[model samples]
Target: MTQTVDLNADMGEGFGPWPMGEDAALLETITSANIACGAHAGDWDVMAGTMALATERGVGIGAHPGFPDLQGFGRRRMQMPHDSLRNLVAYQVGAARGMAASVGGTVRHVKLHGALANMASEDAAMAQACYEGALSVDPDVIIMVLAATAQQEAAQALGCRWAAEIFADRAYNDDATLVDRRLPGAVIHDPEEAGARMVEMVQAGAIITASGARIPTPIDTICLHGDTAEAVGIARATRAALEAAGIALGVFPGRR
Candidate 1:
């Protein structure tokens, strides 16, 4: 049987006069784009432009909501009440939806970004709060969750449409969490290596940890970071490799 999976990337992470990532090039490679909401790394104009490009490329659009810490690029953790977290997610998703709609696109999924995503992956309650916020606005929006984590647990508990994601440029810990970025070789920069690893994981239908432990989980999507030229290369390479391996690349069915 031919295997199919969605290739996704976090994009639109730029402010005025300062652009981040190769979004235009990535739109050509990825099947889905997790666009940054205004709070963490984007503004209305950026969102609209990115969404328009994705629409033109026939890519699936997803909202990437994170903490309000723009300075830290939403990579720094900040404590917030559960209610506040829910509202924050809701507001960002709504803003993304509006921007996408203005560009004749619609948000098909929601993925928490940066520290918020890392935190939620460890705390089922927190993941539930964020997913609930997205659901409140669009009940059919697919929630992208880290495979085999609390985020997945929360989605299953809610019985909402969801998809599992794995990282293409990141090394994983034995427990399935990402390796600390501070560690050497944690963030992979080699395009061929990244592409090969992605093919291996997708074929295994599991997350192969750094120690070679295969953690079985649904591999619905492969996340490629587009924060740099090398990252974009990795994305393209991964897509090519998947196709060469006879794995079909397309938008995930999600839960709907």
Candidate 2:
């Protein structure tokens, strides 16, 4: 039997003339793209252009919705009511779906971004609210969740199509939460090191925490952050490493 997994990255994060990431170069390596939907870092032009690129690359398209915080880049967590959270997700997914359609593609999945994702990974109810918002717009849309966390729990409870994801360039704590970026060694920077770590985690069929503890879970996809200085390098290296290990890379079929 062969092992297969999806490689995804957040893109379309640049707003206006201030570009971010080597999107064109990175698209050559990833299997799926989580595009920002005019919230944290993208505007209409960015979304449309990105969707077109992802469509051309034959990469699976996903809506990467974050909190409405351009200044903080949605990394700073904000408190909001459950209804507000739900609306935020729905509106973003709807926008992404429309943009994808304009580019002759469609949003096949939804992945929460930044603080929204971090919060959801810790609170099942919060995750549920966000997923519910997405379902309201398109019940069939796949929800991508952080594996072995409250995000997973919420997805399970909702009985929606979902994929469990792990981070390739981020370190994980024993509880499976991502390490704070402010913390030492929280974000992995070396391409080769990031690639090697991904291979180990995929082979182990679990998230290997910073302390070297393994927490078993289904890994449907591995994510590489696109906003890093080494983003493209890490993406290519991770893909090469995975293929070298005889592990196939493909778009994930969300668990139904």
Error of 1 at 61 (Å): 0.3
Model 2 residue runs over 4 Å out of place are: none
Pairing residues by index, what is the TM-score of model 1?
0.98
TM-score of each: 0.98, 0.99
Candidate 2 RMSD to the real structure? 0.6
TM-score of 2: 0.99
| Residue pairs in candidate 1 whose N, alpha carbon or C atoms collide under 3 angstroms | none
Give all candidates' CA lDDT scores: 0.93, 0.95
Worst 10 residues of 1 by lDDT: 173-182
Question: Model 1, range 90-164, lDDT digits (tens) per residue?
Answer: 999999999999999999999999899999998999999999999999999999999989999999999999999
